[model samples]
Target: MQQRKQQLLRRHRQRKRVALLLGLPLLFSSALWFWWLPLPLLLAAWVLHEAYFADHLFYAPGDDYDYRFAGAGVSVSITADGRLGLAQLEGIAEADTLLLEVTIKADWRGCWVDPRVLIDVAQPHDQQTFERGCAGRRVVNLSGLGPALAAGQVRLRGRYCRLAGQATLHVLRNPDYACQRMLILAPHADDAELAAFAQYQRGAEVTIATLTVGELEAEPYQQLGLSAIEAARLKARLRSWDSRHAASWGGVPAERCFQLGYFCMQLPAMRAEPLLGHPSKVAQTGDIRPLRKGNALPLPGDVDGQPSWFNLLGDLRGLIEHYQPQVIVTPHPQLDPHADHQATTAALYEALAVSHHQPQTLLYYANHLHDNDRWPMGEQGEGVALPPALEPLTVAGVWSPSLSGAAQIDKSMALGLMHDLQTPLPGKKKLRRVLQHYLAGRRWPRWGVDEFYRKAIRRHELFFVQPWPIKDQAQRPE
Candidate 1:
């Protein structure tokens, strides 16, 4: 009887173990179905929300359209009536005659409409040849022009028939007029206020300059004389800059600076100045020097008694000494395409590397392209918009959120007006709307008022105290 009881107990224990093992998976599977399934859905929704509302979000480019040219000589004029006018070729037209191509962009996605291109010639009765239903582009074959017709100046005008609203008329002359128009429409400097600001008692001096690297975005490394390896290195360096400054400046600033390296041209307008107020002195550099009528120093080749990094360094060092500024503000390396910005950054880094008497240096980044859709993201190519990382710099700074929405709007309007020559083609109202939307949503996490230098370390803008070092000791840790 005892043997039989012991055998039964062993069988009961085995049954209990089997039951426990079977229950474990059922419990686990239940938990996963109830919790994990919902988690993924929730995460997806959050990602979508963030993508739509993120301040740095950029839209993808739409489908491409076939643009054909009307084989005709065209002249475009802005009449006193504030209306656009056009005229066609009537002369012994020859091939490759000067064809004025005016592009009018649409404000939004829509069908094509026949908008009149007005033309005002001194005399209205001139024999003007009209080419109807030609391609969207204007082409003049002046091969058959008689001398009499060749001598006669004909005005040509046509509105953009079918294009998106965000499109701007990119008028292409024999030589590109985009840069010239951008300059012509730039803002005028405030001499009196600037002079007064320069005179204001301060411990430091300030200089403002704009640098450009033509068509860097479309052809980055090759155009800029950088090898693929060098370009990769440069990109890594830029990422380091972004990472180091991201805590204070956000990742967008560095990206903006990088974009500027490619498509940058100095605009006549100084939108940043009002925010910065008047510097102790405004020393312009690069192409900016040509715009200023004052006697300007040549680009620097050396600093103090040392060989500088780039030609502009010597001048910057001299300027720093002459100004005796307690703080020096300049663009980060990402801002320029030609080795100019990188050279400047290197020079500043070198200057600070050896000297104990120098003032605190702060780097500020400006946007390269103003339009929202073109934010240094996927618009141009496959590379990521934000840098992969940031570097530890001697001193870093971030943009202040002090400017109000209205103020930003006013500034944008002023800048747009200043760059009237580069004005978007008709129906580009969407660009203005996009800019306004950006301004409205723009905000930087305030890090209190005491921190002087702010760096964008990653996703956030961080502020740092820029204390000067003692004369004999290593610079204090920021």
Candidate 2:
């Protein structure tokens, strides 16, 4: 795979050089006579870019914490012909749920066409994709194969893709998602919906606490002819309102959804000086003021609403003490590259330490992964596998709660309620955007490629179950 990638890179560079050599003179001449000629050339250039760089079809295995913590229950080896595999369940008791991890090497053809591997283990058939051309280790949930799997051995017959050698399979127990009370910590308003709308929609007592109203990116409201500050304020208020409505779609009421008013992109600065308040650059407001009355935890008399790390942690501690949630869902600091997300989890840990509240489970999610936005590698209503193995994955086990088609539609509708998720009017650049999507073999504004609708509204939502009350932590992982 590495050699094939290198070869493709060399060919891509060669193609670029050849195109430039022939196209520069044409562009110069076209500028003088045919103004429209540059447009076709531009479209051609975009085509070349999409053909070569659009899909990332490479997978490097991250730290397999699941296997490291829970040793394989059964290791199945494929037959010499790569058509059949077998797993012997000896001395194994009855289990409710299990996770099957498959290690595969993607072929060069994966670059042009997305690779889909179908594995049929007796009763239920499952399909797994090497998302974004990744072919390291992909896990599938084995739900109904309970007592039959523990009876004895099982034969695994599946259609194989391009395989170099025998595939290795490890069957391990999946994490439990049972919780009495669940609290989701979202960096922004839509984040809770993106990561765990399905999780809370049909579960025990649930509360969503949004860290910020996500008012920083006011560019979308520029069409409304509002000034930057006014637009930011409006964006903040509307998204805060949208959060309650969106959470309602997930069965969480307005009273249960709390918006901890903090400025976007200011968490890192607040983390540095916990006592100092950080002002919003977009809204031009410095105070930590909730948009709606009684929509947030009440601050102490001495501690007014000021956007500071101390206040943020205080709110988190207050929630933890008040709700006493068994499951706390937040972003993984290491995997998520966003500064606000990292800071949100960091504050949660500090609050946990100060409050000394040990939740039974900590569900960590990563909405912002390494470069590629189009991950899980398929259309909507498809199984959402693990994200690209860019960062060292740290989790006790993987939990992928399957959502019905109706649930997926509800998630899509919930995501659509967010003003930020709506596609902005391309205006003058509309033609360029259309041509780019057309040449890339993609449809525009049908839940934009990077939106939560495409990324989150899937057959299942994925979460990494990190150990609760991390022991001996000087600081969160870097």
276-341: candidate 2 lDDT, tens digit per residue: 889898787886665646574564311587888888888899888888888999987666767788
- Note the Cα lDDT for every prediction shown: 0.28, 0.67
Global local distance difference test of model 2: 0.67
- Rate residue 396 of model 1 by lDDT: 26
lDDT of 1 by residue, 1-478 (tens): 1233345456656765786577567656756778565456545544433333222212112312223322222444534342333234342233212222333332221112212233334343111111112133221211112232345443333333321212212221221111111100001111101111111111122233222222122224445797654553343334223222221111112111211111122211122221121110112112222221221343443122112123233344554554445544333333222223333334455555554347643423322211122222211111111211112223222221112234333322222221111222333334433443353221221321110101111111111212333342322211
How high is each candidate's TM-score?
0.28, 0.80
Report the error of model 1 at residue 73, Å.
Answer: 66
Pick the TM-score winner. Answer: 2
Candidate 1: Cα lDDT at 425: 30
